[model samples]
Target: MRLSRRLEKLPPYLFVEISRKIAEKRAQGIRVVSFAIGDPDLPTPPHILDALVEASRDPANHRYPETEGLPELRQAIARWYRRRFGVELDPDTEVLPLIGSKEGIGHVAFCLIDPGDIALVPDPGYPVYPMGTVLAGGEPYYLPLREENGFLPDLDEVPAEVARRAKVLWLNYPNNPTGAVADLDFFRRAVEFARRYDLAICHDGPYTEVAFDGYRPPSFLQAEGAKEVGIEFHSLSKSYNMTGWRIGMAVGNAELIRALRDVKSNLDSGIPQAIQLMAIAALDGPQDCIDEHNRVYQRRRDRLVEALRSLGLRVNPSPASLYLWARVPEGETSVSYTTKLLEEAAVVVTPGVGYGPSGEGYIRLSLTLPDDDLEEGLRRLEAIAHGRPVRL
Candidate 1:
């Protein structure tokens, strides 16, 4: 059978490969403690699950759902924006529920990119940004996010011709892989850059609520004129321990929201009504769960940072996001360091290079593991750091 050229061009997804490696080790009867994926180990809040159970019991929820989500769900998302960021949104026009933010992030590419169009994607960023553009017959012009730049792209460095040809700009705060946080000022600049280039900005903000140290990440829409040129994708996955629930939303420019909605309407049905109810419960329900979850993550982050620093790996005590982006020991590449930890210590971490070339010297460890597993993993890492052999 012949595969499409696009499919041929795509590389294996990063997380899937990590899962495969983990399975291989587990199959061999080896116990591996992984800090690989950023999936929360915590449970969804009880109130939200109650909402799902109630909704699921209704016969009305079993049927196919509208591609545009329920009015209540959209309104809940709007209310969330207003209360959290003081950003007003027209639920009917600027908000669209998604099966998951990943779905919206990928489909939004089809909305803006025509064949041969360019998307300005961040290097060492979310794979979906570039992969989605490629699948949509668009080229991705990668912008390197250097440590010196606080992981924010320099808009002025984008060549004039490239900017002119680019159709979209992808930004993520509390970013994946890097655990980098961006301020509203950076977003304001991005909004200006998008307007100057006539590019639509696609800001992935799933990690916004997964912050630590009392740091509240700002929404892109909070920036003046952001609604004129960009849409932000947010997910309940990280925020509410709802990764398995697969409910999220896109909000911002009305036209962009409509375009994405139209694309989704034809491609697939909307989120399950029960799940939508759960999401509404999440958004409108008590927000204290977020603070509670962040507290747990903060504890884990502090312990991990101290351990990594002692081992001579450079890692910041990230203020937001459920990840610790650590530089590999000198003379080791991301893949080599990751492989050493997996094979030698029976520990698993993501090789940063999987995100992009600029990530070649780093590794990302997730803070979403259970406390016990985290301690065990740290112990193994310490054994390796101290030049002691790890027990198989």
Candidate 2:
């Protein structure tokens, strides 16, 4: 049997490698503490779960749902957007619920990019951006997200010809792996750039509600003219601890939403009706869970920041997102340091290079582990710092 060329071109998924390493260690009877993935350790709120239970029991919810989502869910999403970001959306044309934002993020490439087209993908970004473009047979033009530039891609540096040929500009904030946040001013500039280049902007914003220090992240759609040229993908995964529910939405340019909807309609079934109802509950119900979850993540971020600093690893304590990006200690590459921690401390952290070439010198630690595991991971790190042997 022959595999497709696209499958051959696809690089190994980052998290899959991390999981493999963890399984290998565990199979040897070594208990590992991992800060590798940005999945929330918290449970879904009771009210949201209750909504799912009730919806699941309804016979109507068992049938195939509309690919565009339930009208009530769409309206709820629009209402939430207006309340949260002051960005009004047309529920009928602008809001399209997703199985998860990842699904839309991947499928949007097919919607916008033809074979041999170009996508401006940020280096050190979520791997899905470039991978999706690749799967669609589009070339990815990597824009380095250097720390010196606040991790924002410098649009001016892109060659004129490359910009002209690019069909999509992929962005994320608060960003994955780096925990970098972008404001509306930057988003406005991005909108202008996209307009000039005639590119569609895809902003992955799953971490917006996961901010800390009372700092709220802005929606790309909140920028003037952003909705004219871009779409924002948001998920209930981080905010409502609903990752397992597989519910999310894309809101913005009606044309882009419709294109993505068309791709989705052909490729897969829509989000389960019960899950859509639960997502609606997440959107319209009390928002206090978001603040509560942020507080917990904030505490963990602080503790991890302190621990990493004491070990002489340079980390900028970010104001948002579920990760702390830290430069590895001098003389160690990301993979080497990651391997060292795994071997010596039974700790698993994601190597930054897994994100992109620009991520080579760093490692990313997620703030989504339980407090007990976090403390133990800290102890193990401290043990390594102090030149003491881990008990294994």
What RMSD, rounded to one decimal, does every model reach? 0.8, 0.8
lDDT of 2 by residue, 135-208 (tens): 99999999999998999999999999999999999999999889998989999999999999999999999999
lDDT of 1: 0.93
Clashing pairs in 1: none
* Model 1 per-residue lDDT at 1: 92
Across residues 50-155, which tens digit of lDDT does each residue of candidate 1 receive?
Answer: 9999999999999999999999999999999999999999999999999889999999999999999999999899999999999999999999999999988899
Estimate the overall C-alpha local distance difference test score of candidate 2. 0.93
